[model samples]
Target: MPSRTRTHNHQLSDPFAAVLQPPPDETPAALQARVEQEQEQKRVSDQIDDELRKERTERKKRSRREVKVLLLGQSESGKSTVLKNFRLKYAPMQWKAELRSWRAVIQLNLIQNVLTLLDLMQDRLAQPDGPRPGSSGGPSSYSPPSYGRTSMDSTISEITLASSRSTLNVVLTQKHRLLNMRLSPLREVETDLRRRLGAVDPEFTFANGEDGAMNGVPGERRKSAREFGVRGWIGALGFPTSGAARNSDEPMPVDKATEILATLRDEIISLWEDSEIRELLRAKCLRIEDRPGFFLSDTARIANRTYVPSDNDVVRARLRTLGVQEWRITLEHNESFGSEWVIYDVGGSRSMRHAWLPYFDAVNAIIFLAPISCFDERLAEDPSVNRLEDTLLLWKAIVSSKVLGKTTLIVFLNKCDLLKRKLQSGIQVNKHMLSFGTRENEVGVVVKYLKDKFKDILRSDASQPRTTYLYATSVTDTKATAATLNIVRDGIIREHLKHAEFV
Candidate 1:
């Protein structure tokens, strides 16, 4: 009984002895093969572990080492223009690839302007209180659209309002669907072009809303008026096999863009130059030249079958922002600063300003653009407030923000050229801004005064402890802007390096 008890105790202590037992010896060849198989398995396992560790290291480095910049400004203040300049300087290949898309946007702008003129013509004709041609009353609502021309050609002028009305009616009757109230014909083409360029319609927000809440649910994409233009052409036929492979059998995407623009060019010009249309625009004080792609002046050339948009033409094209967009590019000329830069551009409208908050934490630097030329203009979204005043208020909020204490603040006093021209044209600064106590309206004086005002605002927001670099820039001039940006890039890199040493 004592012996049996001893055996049971030993068994309890030796629970893993079976797993530890060695196998019986094998033949020499079999042992060698087994050893080889074990060695191969170990090698593959180690390789997989090494790969996983390498990927983790790369991810951590990317998160910690990337340089980020933010572009901030009000709508139409030239933020996108600055972004484009960066592309032209650093990413020429990508820039060229996207240039073809701008032709469609330019064409869309021109077509919309003509449509506005046409709508005005139709509205005037339908006005119950307005005098008809040759019908006696007080002064008629027949003021001609001012192209700065003294008169229309006698041959066209002789076509009186009544006759011109008939001519327009005949044209409209034949193209009733195209001339409909929805402007579907043009919109369909516009939608297709926008889609190819990966554009979705932007949300509308209340003009003064601080949160930038959308009229609809946030991030919900809405359909524009119509969507059946050039896309239909592609579906009914077929897309080129490849955008890079250009031949008779497979024209490039750029060629397709050229064809669309050329097809619409003459039709847009004809409507724009119509005697009645011009007169209506004049009466309404609507100047299409002030708009983007006033292609009327160069219709013959732009309409040529061979024409493609130049880089400058693409730069001049305007499209409003909808939300936040981020662009990442590798540094080519300025490799000392790190290999990559990520830039964030947000919509500058009051409502869209809310979208800027989430990015404030991670941004290394901020480029704030305030168009000094906006002193005389009003906000397009909110007419009650002067644009310059709003810009100043915005600047105060940004520089004073406790959240952005570490962010290097660069203020671009943009559109200096436009300010100079507006001042030269006798637009008095004091007249628009009563804050100026009868100061001279010269460009140099006004610019200095404006800069001081902005500086004063920055000073009042001193709790945040920041340095402000002010640059007088016209972002449209690529050479000058590029020079300024080089200085900015270098400054930012130096500051980042300094900060890194402390961390």
Candidate 2:
């Protein structure tokens, strides 16, 4: 037993002994040389270890100095728009570099508007009792579908037929058919552009009840079925990063789309501007102008070959965020507030909310955008819930989160412009929100009411006491938003410094 134990111990030590052993034929001079060589190696190893330690400490200091902001809101609530504003302000060079790429997206937006109009026109024409010229009625009684267990087709059909009884008397002639045929090539262009934009994923599939679609569908069908979103903006825009190959001469997908749009520009304008078509749109209660990424009104300018998207155009551009996007901007002029700012933009759709949990930790501040204009609107994914209701619920969940207890909460009652427009158009706020009852329907009253509601939620639901900033904003108005952002930037910096013990 003692011999066996000795053998086991010897086996373990054999490898160590081999490593410690020196050359059997070593002379004193050779031994001295080996010792010196080992000593030099040890010195190098120690130097590397010290450098690594210093690097780690520096990384920690940099992280501590970095200011992280998160943009949160429901889909189309202007989260991306706010991010663009930040980039345009603090990261102008980077924003300018990516400006040309937005041409494709703008073109795509215009094409989509055209296509939607064409589809509605075709659907109208197919009806046996289509509205005749000069037909008029009371205001549209159409209410978009509430959340119910129904197939997508049925929901779409209901929406299509909702305004059927109130449609403007517009007749489609053979000219419309000819124009649609002329624009058929646009379908191909759209498919090509979507492929180039990385909007379609072949491997992924949407299950039923996901994204509020009732039927399971392959990701390939998402081209038309789902709101457009690229997997990553860097890859989608073909923006070159470090070590990425750049092919300056390579043909871009936008070029083809642009060429096609330029040729069909007149026809598209004619289709869009036709008095009959305008009446038809009004009759069907299809407010295409209200949709995100709308560019029909700018068709002529956008379809031009030399078109460049203005700063306002980029801010208004709607690119659905699929996951979380991190944008880092080094403050060029403001050194006292920290040199580095990291902004996280997340997908706010109900289906995408799961992706947000991982980011809640370590966020310094959150800019939550609630589009007050959407009080009457329903979530596209879940039509049953009012947009305002959904926003409040989301705000409650965010404030009540224990992980985000220390984070500063900032609320931008966004899209005040749209809210004003809607109010002026005679949409009753109380009709959509019972809680908004008996209040004067003025914009100021509506905004104040909504702001107070948000404040109430923050006060009641927050896990800990914290300061909350509320601003009424029209985020699309670059000038006004810039001013608001300045105030917001200072507030964020102040909070950051306080948290960092620099105050």
Candidate 3:
């Protein structure tokens, strides 16, 4: 047994002994030098370990200090707009850096508007009894059908309106055809821009079930097959990361798109400004101006080679958020509450709501945007679902969530400007929501009614006792939104401090 133990020990130690063995003819000075070298290596290793420990400590501290906020709302409820407003206020430098990149998005918006108009014109021209040269007021003025009490009734009304419009006809002139032919090249530019922006499907068609269906004739399917979206905002602009690309003389995809827009500027302006085209759009109830990312009004400036997007323009720019986007902003001005903030801008479509559950954990606050203007509208993904109803359901689900029991809830009854416009245009709220109950259709009353509804949900549905802050916001108006955001920022920071036990 002793011999077996000795053999096993020898086998294990032989490799270590051989590795530790120095040169056969080693001098004292050489041995000293080897020891010094090993000492230096050990010092470096120890230093690295010390650094790793410090880094871990700092990360833990930051996790406690970081203000994590999640922007929540349905699609087109102004979540992204609110995020842009935050960046505009807190991260001005980063926002300015991304401004030039938005030129492509603005140009794409213009092209899409033009293309949709052209398609509508083509569809109108195809009708058998198209609009005569001077036809005026012959059962031609279009009025949207009234919204019924239930969502099913609303859907039926929409379907009825769509079916009724299919029988009406309109016409276009030779000038319109020539303009369409000239603008055809923009289709290729649109394709190139989509490629650069990382659009999931280049040939994707935006169905008319949402707001502003092409020609407002949903059944006829005169929709434009142009939608530009990116998987992420980072590097989507195709801008240079390092100084290497700046030194090169090559033009980027955005540059080419800019050139095309400049070349076709006159045609685009003419098409947009045509009186007959305006009349046709009015007749079809297609208010292209009210649509998100509408830039045709500024075609002259936007299409110029020297065009640069202003702060308002960038805020108003529409880029669909495909997934949750993390934006870190270090508050330069306010250091008392916290320095670093992480804002998660999540996709708000019904299909994307499933991805939102995991993010609910550890979120410091949730800024829920409900577009009250969409009360009379149906969800694009599920036509049967009313948008306002969807928002209410989502709000109930969020407030009742045990995972978010301790989270701070902030509700922005967003898009109030659009809501006012919609109300002013004779859209009654009670027709769509019976619970609105013959209240005044003024902006203040509507906002209060909606606010009360949200408050009621919070009072009844929250899993734990919590406080909710509510605001009436038109996020597109940066100036007003900036003021509102200041209050929001301070409130969130206060809650964060309380959670960290610093208050």
- Judging by TM-score against the true structure, name the best candidate: 3
**What's each prediction's TM-score?**
0.70, 0.81, 0.85
Among residues 3 or more apart in sequence or in different chains, the pairs in candidate 1 whose N, CA or C atoms overlap within 3 Å are 144-279, 145-278, 145-279, 145-282, 188-229
Superposition error at 462 for model 3 (Å): 1.5
Q: Which candidate should be chosen as best, given lDDT against the real structure?
A: 3
What TM-score would you give candidate 3 relative to the actual structure? Answer: 0.85
Window of ten residues with lowest summed lDDT in model 1: 213-222
Model 1 vs. true fold: TM: 0.70
Candidates by lDDT, descending order: 3, 2, 1
Q: For candidate 1, lDDT tens digit of each residue in 194-268?
A: 666555443433444332211111111111111112212222223232333223233335455456556666566
Model 2, span 84-191: residue lDDT tens: 998888767677667767777777878878888777666667767665555544223333343432231121111111223343577788888888899889888888
Clashing pairs in 2: 147-384
Which parts of model 1 have CA positions greater than 4 angstroms off?
Answer: 1-28, 127-188, 191-202, 205-264, 270-287, 292-298, 501-503
Candidate 2 lDDT for residue 204: 31
